[model samples]
Target: MSITLKLAWKSLLNRKTTALLTILTVAISVILLMGVERIRTQAKSSFANTISGTDLIVGGRSGQVNLLLYSVFRIGNATNNIDWKSFEEFSNHRSVDWAIPISLGDSHRGFRVMGTNHSYFEHYQYGQKQHLSLAKGEEFDGLFETVIGSDVAKSLGYDIGTEIIIAHGISDVGFSRHENTPFKVVGILAPTGTPVDKTVHVSLEAIEAIHVGWESGANLGNEPSKEQLLQMDFQPKQITAMLIGLKSKIQTFALQRQINTYKQEPLSAILPGVALHELWGMMSVAETALLIVSVFVVVAGLMGMLSSLLTSLQERRREMAILRAMGARPRHVFTLLVSEATVLTSIGIICGIGGMYAMLAIAAPIITANYGINIALSGITSHEWMLLGFVQLAGVIIGFFPALRAYRQSLSDGMTIRI
Candidate 1:
């Protein structure tokens, strides 16, 4: 090692406590900055790829965003339902390959209940065109049988054959319960790290069967017996939304136009990617706010690090005299000060990244459960590397003032020790 580097290392070791604290401060700031960026990137990935392998999302005429929200993410109620005839007609269209019907507006213990056919399990895709797989048991086969997502099973402690009651509405409390018409859990889907993880899937017939005794959202006459309910037809009159897969990519726009201009009922068909981009555009402001706050935190950390290095300069003035007496030029003293800062910052950056990985490893499950957002444990991106480069640049810039102070101290001391 060079003499200057050796001296710089010795000086940092002498103020071990202060140097360590400064490094830790920078490390924490890096953690927050990297965490925010990772979440933002992964959130966009998860939300955009929530449903793939489909050409378009078809729903009753409403805002494209709203239809995507209620149909794919199960976020809100549909303003209208497309009649079963309309769905069948579109499903049989020449340009369409497959269509999966979706029925919403019911809940089971705060988790949304989605009524769909076997086609959903067959055609729906997520996370890079990955199909849904059952973690346990098989798909629902009969009326009142249901398949649950991983989050639903984990949250409710449900297993195959476990019966759960459906709620009248999508609220956690105050919704009329579907006590008599309990559904048996037939399958549990593996976690996709998407909205699908929070849904309860049943047949469209099951949705109809449960609402048999209810009219206008309330039970009017006496409820039917189990025998009468079994004998009753279970055909759904309408559906909240439908996902259409086209036979040819070129037919997408043409099919979308056809759906939009359908004479039977007003309908909207949106490309999943386009709608996802629109949604992200609307949410970009909040994302920017988070990034700005994290940047400020990093700046504060750099300032704290600067303050600590500056405070240590007073005690090092005598050391500067000794170095000058040893034939070290003023630039040498300056280099020593700057090199020490560089070493501390390099270590801080390494520690910050390690700490971030540790934090993410521990917080992944909790985040998925609470927010339904997946934070992947992956390598740093080019953008993150650029962020680190900027941090190092800030360290070098912050070191400049301290290096200057040391340079002046060396010139003035001139072999005379200051008290």
Candidate 2:
């Protein structure tokens, strides 16, 4: 056995260049396959963590996914607003522990601005039920003050005390600017790897105060003075949505059912977990497609290994004859070939995982900045272990054809070529 391994190792070293190239090909493919799986799993986890500790998300009558997209992710505009009276009703319900109202439909420099009260910072949670905390300065206090998310502060170069103008509508450009009522950045939130990192938060009263004179989507003459608007009522008549937390986990469904059947207005109440699952369900098709592409890439890499082994067999014909003459059985030659492939594959797998960790460490910040997806630097998952096992198995299976060819050729060319 030792002699066979020594012979196999020397033969691979004899063709070191091709062997190294084949190993690298497999390494790159393994990196890609592992990366895709990692991203898929982490993306789902991040998505699920976006809204935790909240039992139900209440909003104006709409699809569950739609409400989750706009309310939690701030992706789109709400089709309608829930009446403020209704918000008060359910918020004060017996089963509800707390409610955080969310007012949408505003933007600043492409980042969505959210209107909520202090309960948002107190109740809203993410990434392991973690509460929102200010990285610098303090929460917004006055009507014209705002709190910026970590991504907003970093991307736009804004810090605490930087004044910003809010746009009337949600657009990157070509929207009416609310220049008359600029907000001071009073706080900057820590990075949460969730939607919170991309939002600009302010008081609900601030949302109402800014649009004081713009009742009909047009400024009614000049907008009100800061003092004048402050003197006027700042109570919001309607809100886009609310995040609800219950005192008891068992009452979550009953409260959600009550909110859904509220007669005061057309409303929808969706469990955050259920809604998140639905969103992932819609995205499963794309995830499957990515996995399939990665699998094919790995197959192509293994095929490259097979081709190299087959090509090297022709050059090793005399070597195989020498082995046969020395009493090395055909099965030994077969095992030798398989062992070489296994060694190459084992080395390739190690290099692939190493490369994956290095690339993730480098690209994590960029992905978080551009796509808001956080890829964790954690150990391999069970699914990934299975994938690696399958790849190793595939390498052995690919080696079979080459080993069989060598076995048959050695029998025919015993001591010398039959031709």
Pairs of colliding residues, candidate 2: none
Question: Candidate 2, which ten residues in sequence have the lowest lDDT sum?
Answer: 410-419
Give candidate 1's whole-model lDDT.
0.89
Highest TM-score model number? 1
Of candidate 1, the 10-residue stretch with the lowest lDDT total is 410-419
lDDT, candidate 2, residue 359?
A: 93
Candidate 2 residue-pair clash tally: 0
Report the C-alpha lDDT of model 2 over 270-380, residue by residue, as the tens digit: 999999999999999999999999999999999999999999888788888888888889998998999899888988999999999999999888888887889989998
Off by over 4 Å in 1: 172-175, 414-419
Question: Superposing every Cα of model 2 onto the true structure, what RMSD results?
Answer: 1.7
The TM-score obtained by model 2 is: 0.96
TM of each candidate vs. truth: 0.97, 0.96
Backbone clashes for every candidate come to 0, 0
Question: How high is the lDDT of residue 316 in model 1?
Answer: 72
